[model samples]
Target: MAFAANTALISSPTLFTPSKFSSSRLYLSVPYKTTKFQLYCKPSSSLPLTSLFCLRKKEKSVLSALSDDFPAVLDEIEGNSGWDVAVEGEEGEGGFVVQPPEEAKVYVGNLPFDVDNGRLGQLFGQAGVVELAEVIYDRITGRSRGFGFVTMATVEEAEKAVELFSRYDMDGRFLTVNIAAPRGSQPERAPREPGHRIYVGNLAWSVDTGRLEELFSEHGAIVSVRVVSDRETGRSRGFGFVEMSTESEMNDAISSLDGEILDGRPIKVNAALERQTRGRF
Candidate 1:
């Protein structure tokens, strides 16, 4: 029997899908006013029947995002016994966003370059129970970034760890342990103000922050000074950075102190370059 179009008006306005019908071929009748999709099945004398699907009001002349082999998929779907649901994400979830956990995690900095996740968990376990510990690694080089985060079992435990480990020496380097900031809570760091900083090289291993400050304080109002140290030995790395109060002070220091001797070594001074980074995506 041939069923005319618009002959069947589903009272609930429920969708008419081939999965709802058991027959190999269907002369389904649907109205444009009701369904978002229209389905028409073509019966073939071959093993599998062909089906055509179309959206009712969509003006697109094509399926814009279909893969090259999507047509092969339609050919493969024969008389399916059930409806197939599609999900967006790779894990089969519908692109769900996960919320950050409670404030029981601590950021651990000044870590040794060789520290591993297991070591971090063990170290943080000294204060209280540790749920997880992971060392961040460089994406390309796969080296530890000398910093990691640790999740405590309770907020009180996290607080205890912060109190006990902040500035606590680990492998000759003092640690900077504190509550981890929630991701995305901070704005992107602004660029450094122009001409307020200078890079000093050819530093002596004996030179510390205090010594460097004493040396440069004569040139300008010193904002801060730091002597970079090796993560392993906690000794000066023969270079440092200094920030002055103003552009004029920075220029005066760079011009007058470039070849000045400090700690028996002639230091090289120049405007500090912005640090290069592999951007996080």
Candidate 2:
């Protein structure tokens, strides 16, 4: 019976069977008609060979299609089965084998702030075909977060990128490249606080409440803008607060303004935390 190349080898007896035996291990030949590849196995001591190595009937194959040639089988599966990494840690130690995250996604860090997705893709394409590239941006400022992700066409290609591009210099800055963590492994961020107020910091000395309002107004409706000034000097204290007309407007302002460059300096913006007041004893 012809099996899809992407199909799991365990699916059919003709593809993988106990063909050769050594003292301790068994060599299973994965044959697609005329082409043969050996898959090494240590047979289970307690189960029958068929029971231990066979695949279920209903499950779909992992490869793309059954082919008459070996290289085509690699091509078929390379495009179809995404990385399904399985990682297990040892007791008291982190000894494990992890497949590249989600098949071919790679993390790129220490990037220049000006590098966009297109530039990043072109840079990574040197290792292999890049399927997609994206740079994370602050929601308000639309400025890059100095990191991004790239998905390669295949797992081998992703590995090649890590091998060649990790520590690669781009305009004097070295980049950090690695297999991206699976989505489930990422930490959950705390929800933004309620209230239409946001904190803005790292203001240019020349920036006044008016300029602040004008800059943020492009993002949303602003209720008020307050630049905190020094109590003694009357000069700008270099920080301020902005109140948007609504929570949505506040969020928009945060997303657009944080990481925004002003006077060659990136500003910090975030949801306003409630100010703590001293309690009378």
Candidate 3:
């Protein structure tokens, strides 16, 4: 007696041949008509294999979409399990090297004052190749600004860094790690008004009042965009206040901009509190 096999591939599909395994179970994703189902099968001579046929479809694997590294990346991650371990090192040495402009960059905050370029590179290098690591500092005081940027070799590496370090407590502070916004892309600032207002926090340093107003203007009429800056340096405080033309506009701005990424930072948008009227009382 003889048996026949029929297979149809519609899109990207993975098929396991019975000849590959003599006595083991193989799992496959089989698509039929418009439905998809999982198939667990073991081929044996006694059983009719006609029902084990499959119609294949061409589609990119989810894993492939994530990164071309695929299974190899898994091994890399496992091998670097000791990345977070701290080692004794010198301080304030191995100054930062500027990386060529790249999209795969991450922001790191809440760093210890003593952390230098070398220390930061060691910590983030665990995830992937460290193209550059720089600690922001005040030009006048020559002191660390308590935050910095890390540029990875690839987007995959940058994502891995964020997953490994975001909100991870190091030393005595919890770190805030996120994608870095492109340089020079600032937020717009609006003028303070008598109407409704909101508070926006975690803004990127590059963002200015004009950009902030432009972003919030989509929700409603923005009365003003005031990004609080330091009196001495005039740098952004990483937070700002916004006022809208009306209460409805304010609410709309809150709903739209909250949790949205602006200049690679996830901003916090909420209603502003009223100033206490102590003198009147």
The most accurate candidate by lDDT is 1
- lDDT minimum window of 10 residues, candidate 1: 81-90
Deviation in Å, model 3, residue 202 alpha carbon: 25
lDDT, candidate 1, 1-281, per-residue tens = 22234321112343355545443443333334322222233343232213433222213222233335544544454345122212222232233323225689899986767789999999889988888899998665576766899988888999999999987767644677888877779746557556477999999889977688777888866655677877676667899998776789899999999999987999999999776687772
Per-candidate TM-scores read: 0.37, 0.34, 0.34
Per-residue CA lDDT of candidate 3, range 164-241, in tens?
Answer: 998675663457788887779764534433658799999999997668867887886554566777878878888888
TM-score of 3: 0.34
Error of 3 at 44 (Å): 61
Q: Which stretches of candidate 2 lie over 4 Å from their true place?
A: 1-101, 186-281
Question: In order, how many clashes per candidate?
Answer: 0, 19, 27
Worst 10 residues of 3 by lDDT: 81-90
* Candidate 3: segments with Cα more than 4 A from true spot: 1-101, 186-230, 233-281
RMSD of each: 17.6, 17.3, 22.7
Q: Give lDDT: candidate 2, residue 90.
A: 28
Of the pair 1 and 2, which is ahead by TM-score?
Answer: 1
Mark the 10 consecutive residues where model 2 has the least summed lDDT. Answer: 35-44
Say which prediction, candidate 1 or candidate 3, comes out ahead on TM-score. 1
Per-residue C-alpha lDDT of model 2 across residues 82-194, encoded as one tens digit per residue:
31212233233343423333869999986766799999999999999888899998665466766899999889999999999987877534677888877778755445455
- Deviation (Å) of 124 in candidate 2: 0.6
